[model samples]
Target: MTETTHNTVTDERADLLETLAKHRQFLRFTTQDLTDEQAGQRTTASELCLGGLIKHVTSTERNWANFIEKGTSVMPDFASMTEEDFARRADDFRMLPGDTLEAVLAEYAEVARRTDELVAALPDFNASHPLPKAPWFEPGARWSARRVLLHIIAETAQHAGHADIIRESLDGQKSMG
Candidate 1:
């Protein structure tokens, strides 16, 4: 078992947490030394920005963590989402006024902590829940808590790559040489 400050986690849980944490660090590294404007600036043709990527990943992790705990009730009804809903979702990729890089990082850190805590404390990784009704998901599909953790790790890693590209474009500073 992996010993955490608040709880002991099984080896599987520890591995999951370690992988997610590594990706989260990579994502956050891209934002280092960036001001709010720099973080929000679109470095490429895509609408994604460094700060926005962090915000998006933070939101995604939080939602998925909630799903692991509370199931589909925590997810939005994507099938019935309005244009306004989509627009609001799009805002997650932008750093609006009053958004600071510090605050965004702080929020992401807090979310990660909560997710780690939940994962460590969960008694059964095999417990499963039906996915929310969404076109992308197979009908009657179910995902175990283990699956949800894996999904969060994949999502974070993908966005970290995106953030690395954005960072390189922004200032020619690569996350790795």
Candidate 2:
């Protein structure tokens, strides 16, 4: 490849990483100055809470990044799940007992670090991966690595907005001006 083309791609990757980082900063800002109880409180009618949003996004990004790294998936054993297991899965969007904002934030940082490292080390952004056999996805759809990164950015941006609203309801605070 030409030097100019290489530079352009590097610039684009940096821009994408910067955009994701900015959204993540907003999400973190929303949780600032909040206690564990406050972070877990359902300030609005929606089931979403600050702590839960952080956990959800962290897990979602990490899982997708892992899929990109590994071409195939080992689907979860839903059939063998007990009633309690199902209940816990249902509550994955919630901050149950023992959940803390500090822990969630720390885990999220680790996820971000791992994802950034993976992205930097990737040779081709156009590499393709087969769609996992999940009921929620179409049968034969495939996604390129670039698409996965874009999806992660979109998910983070969307959840950042959600976190802003939740934070506003908490104490009339806004994540941004």
Best by lDDT: 1
Task: Name the TM-score of candidate 2.
Answer: 0.87
After superposition, which runs of candidate 1 have C-alpha atoms over 4 Å from their true positions? Answer: 1-6
Per-residue lDDT tens digits for candidate 1, residues 1-177, read: 333445678777888899999999999999999999999999899999999999999899999999999999999889899999999998788999999999999999999999998999887788899999988999999999999999999999999999999999999998888
lDDT for position 64 in model 2? 81
* Model 2 lDDT-worst window of ten: 1-10
The sequence of per-residue lDDT tens digits that candidate 2 reaches over residues 44-156 is 99999999999989988888898788865632444466788777765657888999999999999999999987877677777878777656667778887778899999999
Candidate-wise lDDT, in order: 0.92, 0.84
Q: Which pairs of residues collide in candidate 1? A: none
Show model 2 residue runs off by greater than 4 Å: 2-9, 74-86
Instruction: Please give the range of 10 consecutive residues that has the lowest summed lDDT in model 1.
Output: 1-10
Compute the lDDT for candidate 1.
0.92
